[model samples]
Target: MKLRERLEGKRMLLTGVTGFVGEALLHRILRDLPDTHVVALVRRKGSLSGRSRMEQVLNKPIFEQVRERYAGDLSALLDARVTVLEGDLSDVPALPNDLDIVIHCAGDVSFDPPINQAFQTNVLGTEQLLRRILDSGSNAHYVHVSTAYVSGRRRGAIPEGPVEHDADWRTEAHWGLAMRDRIEETSRAPGVLAKLRRAAERDHLRAGPITSAQDTERRRKEWVDKKLVEAGGERARSLGWTDVYTFTKALGERVVEEVGAPLPVTIMRPSIIESALETPFPGWIEGFKMAEPLILAYGRGELPEFPASPDSQCDVVPVDHVVNATLAAASVLPEPGTPAYFQVTSGARNPLIFARLFDLIREYFDKNPFDMGERGAVRLPIWRFPGGERVERTLVLGERAHKAADFLVTHAPRGDRVRKLARELDQQQRRLDFLRRYHDLYRAYLETELVFTDDNTWALFHGLDPEDQREFSFDITTFDWHYYLVELHCPAVTESMRKYDVIRRRRGRSAPQVAKQLPQGEGIVAAFDMDGTLLSSNVVETYLWLRMPELDGQGRAREVGALLRRMPGFLNAERKDRGRFLRAVYRRYAGADFQELERLVDDSLSQHVLERVSAAALRRVREHRAAGHRTVLITGAIRPLTRPLEPLFDEIIAADLAIDDRGRCTGFLTRPPLVGEARAAWLRRFALQNDFDLAKSYAYADSHSDLPMLRAVGRPVAVSPDVTLWREARKGRWPVEDWKTSSSVSRLTLPGANGGSSS
Candidate 1:
């Protein structure tokens, strides 16, 4: 097959020119029929950014062949044979003139698509294009790309011919259970971060267990319904098409009949098509639609449970075969009064057993032996989401996804099983929202005994020689569904996994995990703070203000806490700059503490630290330990004042005096004469005298007064930041971060300490 032969003088018009089938179709057209002119209709108003939708669509890997043919010089084709018109199908007077052929390959194919858009393009668009073709008077052949699922209302053995019956479109629920817990997401909307966060959370959730069988089934159903709402299905009614995509596709067939009564039209319908194997190329797939779930769920060990019967037949086709059928239909068929119908499908005479498909995929994965790194392959149970009478067995299965998830989890340390469970719950909620918003069509796609017949197609296939059959036959009988599925399923899922970069699987060696191990070496000084930043007290707690009146010096202690809690809300607003700033600070300094000091802060001092432990302040102690850095807790508050928070740090250097063994107050300062320049001054001198590395030591505080103390360290991190340190950071561009930036955490511990205790 070469391009210079057929297209040497012919001209063609192609819509959906950048789509999966369209791209493949164009490549085949160019190769088999060279010198042909191709006119690609692209939207002028593209990404709503600046990139042309054509460029965006062509960037996908599926369009590689087409892109290569054009050699990035689509303009040459545009100026010569390929002209990219900046117009939409819905726009009228679609054709400038008439052509030899009009290949309309554009239309929504989502099984669970929206109600309205389904008909707008599938029906109305097709009719509009037909009218233009008729008006051209160029005696052009019109070929439409329709899905096999267009048999929306039909069941059992489907024929291999164009269906002309008026279809009853489904506008309401498939199962008729009103959904109540709808989460409004803006991913499909204008904003990006809102969409990103939602996407992140959804990814986070799916990483967990499905909980119970009932829950899994319910989610699956919801997922299907969710997909229906995404495409313009609900919006297409105004466009005069039926409400459902499948029904509308059937309707589109009739629309062709009405307007294109005399024009040459071919309705090419293909069954569930997978990747190619022999012809053209082997294993080239675009997405994970159709049978992706069966393979992936099974691969992850989550799909031992079946939704449909094992005995059912799942007809599938190869992309190359579909391409061949499409090309052959276009090149060979002569223009007739009624359109030539070709069903490129599978089943009955050309069926592959669904049970065999599932069985082989499972067998291959088990025997193929590929290491997915440290976590190993996804742990599968004999059954998924088991419970009640089999609760104990379920427990073991669940445990495997948790504790055995050792290599699976990353970034965050493996903890109690409850942690994994909590993460799972949070993630599912987000996924539910995402499914409802962005993937409505995916959610609404119906699952039935959906099978197609291709008697006419088989005849066409058999008419050709055995070699021709290999080249042009789309006969489903020849397909090895197992090979097709694994080849098709792996790339999409793998691409998605790569895009998400989920290192936190229940297995695998995580990126440089630094656990907050108990501190070993001794520290010289421990500095701490009270109020929300330290003891987790109410921002306006008067006792805190009274002790650190300097915080009131600018009304900042409360100000900083207020800023941190409002972080997430600000990320989506015009004030994102402020949010970015706060986020940075929280990361570098929020948990800046000495690990060695944590036990002391917890045991000896925490109980008497004037109040309960502040998880925020305790975090600082853990960080220093995690870094193997020595620490000294310094504060203006009394020793008993920070007692509860004491074990979290090394030594307490407080304003309060310590009692000797004689139970007498020693007026001598535990801290050296370290104040103002004397603070950085004496601290540096004392550290050196005591063999403490001034370059390695760190100092933490909650006030502008601590600037000198901060400068004494190699790294200066400001927690929940203040106006003073915030300015210094900019001048120096010091490292900043917000601790909460990593993962959405459980409830933040509300502050409890009063009278301000600093560690």
Candidate 2:
């Protein structure tokens, strides 16, 4: 009989039906091999019954063709031909014993999942399934779906066969046990307990001061879990695997060999599976898979750079190709002995290089850039693939820059320009760190020259009759990379992204009037610093020195006296470590009612500070506002102080104190204070979001602390004369206008003055 004829009337037990490949395979079998009965394993999810989940799975777009052929009555079709087994591979529940074929497709696929969770789903789960099949005395031909990368870091032509090194199952078991023991031991260790205590203290300051024994245990467990994940990554890298998923999947393959030795077994190793080429529907994908996230990130101008070598051969195969190869392998099994291995990969024949893939992505997105609503279109960033070595160098540079920035931000004055640069540098450093870690995880694969050989796969296909070959053709050589990627893959990925809100497609004219009028381009915004430029006295210091005493009513004298005594120490701290001092001062207000604090700050600002607003500085602000430019109050001052001045500016960006559910101050900021280079970063984001023209915008400040914000705009003006500001403004040839009552109305025209319009 032919391959389809052989599969007809056969009872096949399929695992991971909800997975990408499994869903495709299920569709193929049900659609083509009409007589075959399938037994699918589905685990119960929260609130949803197992059968209900399976039903939902069948309704997915992957099964669109199947649904259409059956007129959307998937339940009726499944009821007649498939058995929804409601249990997980981790469980010891009874499996469908009376089976002709068993396809194990379920395995952990997460790049960096929790260590124990990866082990349980990928390794232990496979072992349990194998045990269930063997112990039931079922004469099923087991077809285990694994990955070609399970060969790990082997170079050159990786053959379609068993893994290179012999798996030590006992050693793996012992290591797992030791890891479990370590987890339990470290969760209660003194060092861990101390870390928990520090974390608890921070939590108390942020939220309410409440911590239970259970809360402490939860924190301890979280720490242990994080450590376990780190250990798993380290272990996987040491053993030549990319991540826990691959490492554990390799272990699962070993277990399958040991446990299913007596049964007829076939191991089908497929490469990176993309969307379906010619099955189900063209470009049918579920969630984002493989390198799609990177693709999306690049298209949206969010990705920094591609770290891999552009010329590296991406060993990718269509999902349908793998499914066909899998069914073909199962149909004609080898003599009852060691498991038959067939690599279903595309590298040997239809190899698509990373450079080519990236080109296709660029080509697709170039035509259709992602829209960010009123923020305008994301400018397609320069596509940089500096390769591995340059990426490492970039990472090192970023780290150094970050360290320097951190030090400056900590030691520099509260509202200094150096602090803003530091914060911006710090953000760059974080992105670099993330990229470095990502590079480390996948560096081996990118560097590897491995081309997975599919000799066995081709031989199996050649053994079949012409009719059978035509029925289930998995010829890797026939795959057209350009057609598959450009015409189908890229478009499909973009469509899916839009569906999931990963990209916001431009809405039609029917969109809301408010959204339409949000402004998009060529509009200017003027950012003004409050403390030194607009106000004569520092708002934060003034609040502490004068207003805070009023808030303490009866203890006014004691509190004011205490603040005065601490003033010298705070000043010393300001010169030494400003960040720490800022945090310390904020911590004093923890647990204070937010509403009461707001009222006090409002009273203080209007009564004492607002009258002190410089006349010249106010003129500059009014000029920008009168010119229909967006006026922004960018300050290092507290939000409550800025609130009273909100009417003067269209947007107020400042340090906001964290408030808990009870409307009490949490002694911490809701986010990092927008000061220093951070202010500049915020402006850039604000300009993007509000469609402002930063190049045409203006900035006015008294202190050199507003350097970043000033540098960001086209017209940067020094409002008042501070020694540092005067010197820097003179050196850089930036406009200088003293806003003091002494020089009010008369603007200082320096040597380079060409009698330009001041505003």
Candidate 3:
């Protein structure tokens, strides 16, 4: 009989209903095999109950076509045709006695899961389920879902058959016991515990005080969990598996073969599963999968290089095809002695070369660019798919260059070009780090040159009548790679990424909204230093240099010559007291109209400083504003220099020059300049006069002279500090930021000399 006819009115148990392939199978069964009753196993996520989780999964866009089919009667259909089983696989005691089919799809898919976790869930879990089936005496046709990567690092054509016992092979139970023993040994090792303790303490020191015992205990647990995951990755590589997920999955298949010896069993191994091609609905994917990250990163121009063989096949199959092949395998009941196997992959039929896939990806992202707001649109990066060894060598050289650039930026003469070069190198380093991570995680898989044989899958397809063949279509020979990737896969992946970005941005913190009423003296204050903290360079010096050419035509030639002659004296005064030098520097504008100088400062600020505003400082100002704090710009420079930033601040405080009745500038200060201790004293007086809480205020500065003011505030931040101030900030453990450059320039890079071509 046909599969659907036999499936009608049969009791089938399905695991992993919330996963990608499982959801597709569930939808297919409900829509086509209408009479099949499905008992689905679902795990509770946090506060969500099993039934609630199932409802959420069904409501996902992947099941949208099924929902449309049933219309308002969807709930009625699900309630009648589906049964929810709550709890994990290992917790279950026995299978339903009336179960005619058992499709085990639930397994951990984490690439770097804990060693014990992968084995327990994938291998032992399968053994438990099979034992339960045997104990209950249910004559169920079991279908175990596995991955094509279980072929491991093998080359040449992999056959669709049983995983035979070789010289190194052991029984599944023994293998599980050995892995469990290793996990226990690693967990309780003295060196491991000591490492965890030291790492936790370092993390706490980097953050703040870890006062509570519960907090320390939590950190210890987190460290242990991280260690376990690392160990799992190591073990997988040593065992010739691509990852912990695939390694344990291979063992799971072995378990099924061993335990289901007398039962009718079939194992289906599918390749890299993408969205559904023809069934359920097109362009339906649940979340970001293996290849989507590389795709999105390349689209955003983040990942420019990767290590992969250009000639190798990608071996991708749609979820619907995998599901169809799975059902087909289950229908063909195996003999009592031997189990059947099917490789549900497209590599052998419709092979897609890596070069072709890369071209399609580039074409798709080129036509539709990812928007990145003010920074500009994201341009797609060039794909450098040289051999793995060549890519590794290039990355090493790139890392060395990043380090050299870092040292040069620190020690070279300080200027815009220097800072820009530093920023560029830092960005390159971050990209390199990302590439390195990708290489480490996926190197084995990407380097694989094997093609899986889907002989059994095709055999099952041809065995079905033409009508059944069309109904349950697992035939991948007719699949089109370019159309599927460009029209369906890429667009679907991009839409999912954009939707996620929208949700994240909405939930993220935003800039402070403008309040209708201006803040008063009673509110909290966030004082910011004006010069290097906000502007990229010193405003006083830059403004003076900018006005030098204009001063050539004025009657100030003699005075300018006199000032230049006394430059050494001015420099000496600056060494003794910065306040005095600042006070005397205003004499350059002595005879000029005060209003004209103000206009000059304003014009110069608009032309030079506005675009050079530090992004980090702007973000912090917005954060403080969002928190309802009054932002104040505090500087020793005159008010005209800081007036352009007034809109971003609640108040501006600066040194004032004595003006004559005719608005002409006098070459003297009205009061002592606000510098060093004077600035701290002013803050104290301002807080007292306004009835503000000193302990709740914040201050940001870049110079060591502003140490007094920083120490007076409750939260002190050091922004783009000089050498002395950076040292002091480190001593006090103050939060320091490089506001002169973008955050992209601050990303971590592997150590190397900056002497190579740009990546």
Candidate 4:
């Protein structure tokens, strides 16, 4: 019988219609078997209904061919033959009584998920689904989609049959689910809490006590997640499986055998599914799959050497082939109370060696290298196929060297040169981390010795009519490995990478135009951070500009030497306590005449301070003032240095220096410095006293020390932020902007100044 004819006029219920393989199968069935009615079971995402999500999925590129065939009236076709059900496998909804087939394609696919999470979805979820089907009283043939890796760590030929395991599925499921509570209980032990609290204190030293406690709780949750992942991996390995995913999948198969009674069952296991061959379109893939990450890493010159033998068989099948095999398996109903097994694989029939695959990737990259902007075209690295132990040793040594370099850079004197070197070191560390992660995740798969056999799958393909075989062929022997790797798969991955790059660039360039226009009235305020956000100069630079001119050549040399000797301590203090660092810095002004400093600030306002101000920041401040929003300059720089810029803002809250009776600086602050949590607290109280609505206010900062202040406002903008602040901004989806210094401008300006620009 033809494949389509066997499936025609049937009512099918399909789960995981939103995933890659499930979506492809649904498209194939809808396009080929027009008379068939399909009930698509999909889980609702955040704020999006399952039906709405399905509409989005149908609009993907994978469904373009079918959409065109229906003349862009895919909605009409869906209305006629498709039924979208909002449900999940853990809690199965009502099943159709007249169902002809049930394709179970939904399960957790992550390799190292938490033990309970994997068991709940892959094992218990499957059991629940089977029981629901039985309750519906529909004698539908159940086809469960699984993975070939369920054969586990056995290093030999794997047959198309049930996995041999002594562990009972019920006991494994119960223990896995119970492990979560045990882990959570252990996480609250005194020793664990003490360790996490110490780490959090170090991380949030400048943010105050409340922020440190919050960080401790966050770290505790992270520790629990890490422990769960480790426990899952260990248990999976104990059961002779590579990871939790395959172990739970094996248990899922056991569920099918034990729970699916008196009903025909078929198990379809596909190996390492990749991009499509020729079905919907060439080089069509939804997202990055198993091999694409490593491929792209190699193309980008990030992976120096891999841990795999040259003779190892790399079993990879296209998604279209898997989809076709699944449909074919679904078309043929097995005998009642009997389970049929089919392994959709390419290892036994036409094996592609690791060396050959590497060569093809190298050749493709050599012809069309990745464009890495200023770094020039990427040069492919020669794969020596080093031993796993040796590769691991190299990574460890590289990490050690990277840490030493980071320490040296951190303690070095702060300047443009040192900052540049620090950025370079950060980039290299990220690349090194990527390499380590890739090796840890994929080393086992790359060096595997097991090969899956597909005798039953081949027989099913041969049983099809000649025309049907031509239309739905999954013949691995006829596939062109070179063409697929070089022309289709690699290019698809590259396009996906390019799209991601475009998104990142857009994020970096996005402006705060929306935030500026959102609120009005005097109760709305705009807060600005001074040192790095609004000006290129810092407290040290401003102090130097005032104090350096007072000394001659030898005195100036002594002053610079003193500052150099104290730089390390200053940096340490700044990292741990920004307020303390400001106090220490202000001490350098002792014994200097306050009147003389004021005169010097007036003389150098245009050349030193005003020239360092960012034009973008100046414009944003004016725009806020023009809209009747109060403008506040909150900085740690001393009041003397900021006095000239008072015309630009309604309020300037800066550090004030204590003076002796003779007007000489007393080397102490009149009040506590406004920084970190203290600054956030001041902002809150100021808002309450002035009737300002903080939820309608904006705050701009550049350093992680200002995280509390940024969080206190409704709209936070990170202006040329540091690494830690940048990471926080990305997580919060806060807007980031790079403000460059306006070197040509020698005056400060505002919207409603009495004399226009201030000098």
Candidate 5:
């Protein structure tokens, strides 16, 4: 049963030879029937018209295997006997002469198809191809790919044969297509004539005319819908098809059944086909227009609370099975006058219930966890199920948010959003500039997902005899859905991510000369936000920072002691997450002097930031100096408390310090202590005046409050970030790192002044 023996040197023409099903079939045809010349439909070489579509299908891994299997270039075989007619399917199907088999798999597959396109390809285009077979004067097998749902109104127990047509109901969807064509034609016609007529009116607002062509093909829209109802919902239920795709597919079936004569023909009805488990290479699929959304929702962890009866049937099959079945059907094609029908499905006969499918998914996830990016391998506590009503409530809340924003814009923060967006845009531009300046060392984060189905496909080849099935047994009954869903899907993501990483790393290596090293010298103080940027730790409630002084008027409840004193009630209150309690416990009203704070900082250094950094980050600090960058620590931890960090850098800048009469503390800052705008602007001015280039600087920070400092620097990275910081970083396209273990000193801290600290 060699391929050369099967085709007997005859030529085969295929319309969607580059498509998912077609590509696999093309491979099968060429592999099993080597002597069979493949006349694949390819667009003109230099045409920009369908490049995206063409490249996506033709450049598949299967096609590569086809070329390799032939032991030479596919182009050579094509040039010799496999003719590639370059033309659009919508145009008349001008096919090659003298073909043995004509497998048509091209055209629209989406349920909600844009109009004019459905008939052009699915119905009329198919009709044109069949005519091409007749016109070429060659007896070819018309292997038309029709949907299983073309059964129209047939309910249960679909027979494995052509739907018996009643004498009265012969012409099915042709009437609708004719009606729709006119509507489509009128919709595209010149509305300018009407506009011109209006302009020529006796007494109108005569400033020429105002028109941009919007004419409703109302009669057409209504006609098609009525026709869909008449034609039945087989197309709807089977393919989840809308009026456009279903009626047209129904039309395709009727047209072929009526007109496909004087030639051998077989219509294949493929149900929901999914990823290949064992046949060919695993997980081979093209654009997932149908199954993609579900996959995307799953990947995003949004499908955890979906609406589906656990007991509902979920039939799926691998694509290779369909290819095998199609081939077998082709091999045993009945002579002209007799048409064969193969319902390649895994419906109730071999049910794969929703519960079983979900269990498989859960099992897959349990064994092979999906990468959560920066979130780490998460056994994320399942979010509380918010029903459909809750989702509506969220939508309502969204409206409320919009209203609040509108009110705020009208009242206080007038144009604040505009200003904020502009500032953000400017910052993003600077980051891009930096990345481009050092192209080799920078990268843009690129992400993509994989989705597919294969049920009728597995049964496609299974329709053949036992020996044939053995050779091409692509059934899914024995498929390990869990392993496939987990392993098959995750690899695609991981491999794509790995490739993306490689591309980005290569890009990052192209970083500008200045990006390689920070500016050196003692005078060049590159001040950085301690929490996220320079040092890694939460400035707010990090376990270490929580031990800092209370800073109440007395200052007696110092550091850990103060925390311990308030911990019992605050812990209870904090669990409720109220604003007032948090504010009272966190914000320092009466502050400490620079000197006294420094003393406390040095004394309690180990309890504060010092114990946080790992050995690796400490090494990075040394590397920073060796690279000639003058590092300085900057924080919002009140005054002299920041002084303990001085020894690790050239200088330290904290919230301004003030002292009263004789070495006692002052409640308020000495000057209008820099924060937000004042902080970043001051740093920028200092860098400019001190010959330090903001364009060549780098800063890191943890909290959202320190975002200004991070954004001001050329390279602003985040470490152990808060939600706000993480989102802003993404929007701003900033780098992020989280070295928060004992092995890495990324967030190092020095001892505090005395036995207390203010972090």
Candidate 6:
């Protein structure tokens, strides 16, 4: 019988209609089997109703043919032929009395999900659905969609049959489901909490106590999740499976055999399903799947080498082929109390090795290369197919070196040069992290030697009528690997990525601009960080510029040599306690004539301070002043250094050094340094005293140590931020900008001045 003839008047219930294969299957059934009634089981998401979600799915490009056939009245057709069920496999809803088939396609496809999540969706959910089918008393053919990798860790030809195992499904399900609570309980132990808390403090050092506490809790949950993933993977490997996903799926197959007895069951397993071939248009795909990330990374020149043996069999099938095979399997009802198995894969028939696949990908990318930002078209790398172990070792060593470089760059003095280096390192780190993640996830599958035998599937295909075969063909023997990948799949994936890039560009352009959207009022204050925000020069540089001029060239050389010798200690002290670092740096001014120093700073203001000021930052300050908003300069630099820029701001809150009766410097701060929590506290007091609304005020800073100050205001911009501040800004979704020093201004040299100042 033809597939449509068998399923013409069938009442079917389908799960996983929102996923890649599930969505394509749904489109095929609705378009081809018009007379069939389908119950689409979908879980409600947030505020969207199940019916609305299904409508969204039907509106996708895969359903374009269906939409055209129905003359845009797809909604009316859906009303007549489809019923949207607002539930999942875990909680099966009431089924129609005369249901003919139940297609369970939903599953967690993640390789290393938390154990509890894996079992709840894959094993127990299947058990619940099977039990529901038994209770419904409908003699429906149950089609269980599973992966071909369920043969787990086995080599050679894998036949279409039950997986050999020594463990009980019930016991495995019990342990997997109960692991979450155990991991959560362990995460709350005193030692664990302390460790997590310390890490959180280091990450969110200047983000205040409340923010740090919140981060600690977030870290605790992440730790629990990580432990759960580790435990699940360990359990899977112990039971001879590659990962938790395959292990739970194997258990789910056991559920179909044991709990789903007396009901006609057909288990259909497909291997590494990719883009569509013909049905619902060629090259149709949803989100990025198993192999797309690796392919895209290679095309982008981010991945340098492939990590699989050249001759290893890569068993891949198109989504449309899988969909057709599923429909074909649904057509044949098995004998009562006996389940049939079909492995819908191409490995045993026309196999495509890893080498050929890589060649095809490279060919496609060579013709139409991926855009590499400033580098234009990416030049594809020559893959040596180095073994997985070698590639992994190289990535590990690179990551360790990256960490050491990161440490050195982070502790370097806060300046434009260091900031640029930090940004470059951040980009490299992200790329390396991406390579590591995909390598770990796909290494086993790419290197596996198992070739799934699809004898049962081919037999079933041969039994179909010629016309039916023409209409719903899934013959892997006739599948052209070259045309499908180079002509269809690669183009489709790159097009999708291009669309995403467009959306990202639009979002970036739409980000909030602080200067253009400032409110006008005295209560609205605009706060700016002096060192890296307004001026490219830091406290150390400003001090050297002022103090070095007062001494001869020998004194200047001696001062710089001493500062370099103590630089590491200063950076260490700054990391441990900001106030101590400030005190130590200011002690160099002890015994200096305060009046002479003040005069020198005033004389050299235009050369040292004004020349280094960022033009964009100065314009923003002027805009705030013009709008009648109070502008404040908050800095850790001493008060004398800020005297030059005093005219731009209404208030200057900087460090003050103690002066003796004769105007000699005491080098001791009269009050604690305004940094971290102290800066936030002082801002709150000032806002209260001046009747300003902190919620309506604006603050800007570049260093991570100014995070508390940034959080204290409504509008906080990160100006040419360091690595730590950049991460915090991204996480908080705060505005980030790179304000360069005024380009038109030249570096001024004072007559008889010695070496360059340190920054």
Residue pairs in clash, model 6 = none
Judging by lDDT against the true structure, name the best candidate: 6
Per-structure clash totals for the candidates: 98, 6, 6, 0, 61, 0
TM-score ranking, best first: 6, 4, 2, 3, 1, 5
Candidate 1 Cα outliers beyond 4 Å, as residue runs: 1-8, 45-74, 77-81, 162-243, 334-336, 368-374, 381-421, 428-451, 462-470, 486-534, 539-759
List per-prediction Cα lDDT, in the order shown: 0.52, 0.73, 0.74, 0.85, 0.54, 0.85
Q: Is candidate 2 or candidate 6 better by TM-score?
A: 6
Q: Clashing pairs in model 3?
A: 400-752, 400-753, 401-753, 401-754, 404-753, 404-754
Which stretches of candidate 3 lie above 4 Å from their native place?
68-75, 165-227, 371-379, 399-430, 498-759
lDDT of 6 by residue, 513-584 (tens): 565756778788888889888987666677777777777778888998999998989877777667788889
Model 2 ranges with Cα > 4 A deviation: 68-75, 196-222, 372-386, 399-434, 465-468, 499-565, 568-759
**Candidates in order: C-alpha RMSD to true structure:** 15.0, 13.5, 12.5, 5.3, 16.0, 4.1
Better of 2 and 3 by lDDT: 3
Candidate that beats the other on lDDT, 1 or 2, i.e. the better one: 2
lDDT of 3 by residue, 1-759 (tens): 787886778889899998887888998887788778998878788999888888887777656666776674657657887888777776765567888889998888867777777777888888888888888888888889989888777889999886543413245335544665565566557776666556544322212223222335675566656666776676666767777777778878888887888888888899888887887777677787778888988998887677888888888988888988887777777886587888888889898888888999999988888877656678777776878898889888888878786766655544446545655765677788878878877777787889999888888899987888887898997768878998998998899778876676675523222233424434677888887778765534544533453444452366456777978787655545667677768766576676876766565444344555787678778777877887888887777767667788987888787899999878776887777666777888888887777677878887766777787887677776654445456557676667765534321211111211111
Error of 4 at 682 (Å): 2.7
lDDT digits (tens) for residues 1-759 of candidate 1: 322333356677888766667767766665455567777776566344212665565565554565566686644434654566676677744576747777887887765454444555676678777877777677777777787766654457777666645333223222211221232232223463344444333322211122122334454445444554533354333333333566667767777766776877788887777666554456666666566655554565544344334555666777777877776666545566677778777666656664666566766666543345565766553432232225334334654555444334432321334334434643443433332332233322222355676766676666666665665556666655555656554554445553443543453321222223533455434344443245434222322322232244355556556655764554332122222322332222222122322333444334333334345446766777666655566544434445555556656555433345654444433443223344556577667777776554555543334556676775565554444344454355554322222232212322223422332
Model 6 CA deviation exceeding 4 Å by range? 68-75, 194-215, 373-376, 414-417, 498-524, 540-568, 585-612, 638-644, 656-671, 680-697, 711-714, 730-759
Mind sharing the TM-score for model 5? 0.51
Q: Positional deviation of 244 in candidate 6, in angstroms? A: 0.9
Locate the minimum summed-lDDT window of 10 residues in model 3.
Answer: 750-759
**RMSD (Cα, Å) of model 5:** 16.0
Q: Candidate 1 vs candidate 6: which has greater lDDT?
A: 6
RMSD of 4: 5.3
TM-score for each candidate, following the candidate numbering: 0.55, 0.66, 0.65, 0.86, 0.51, 0.88
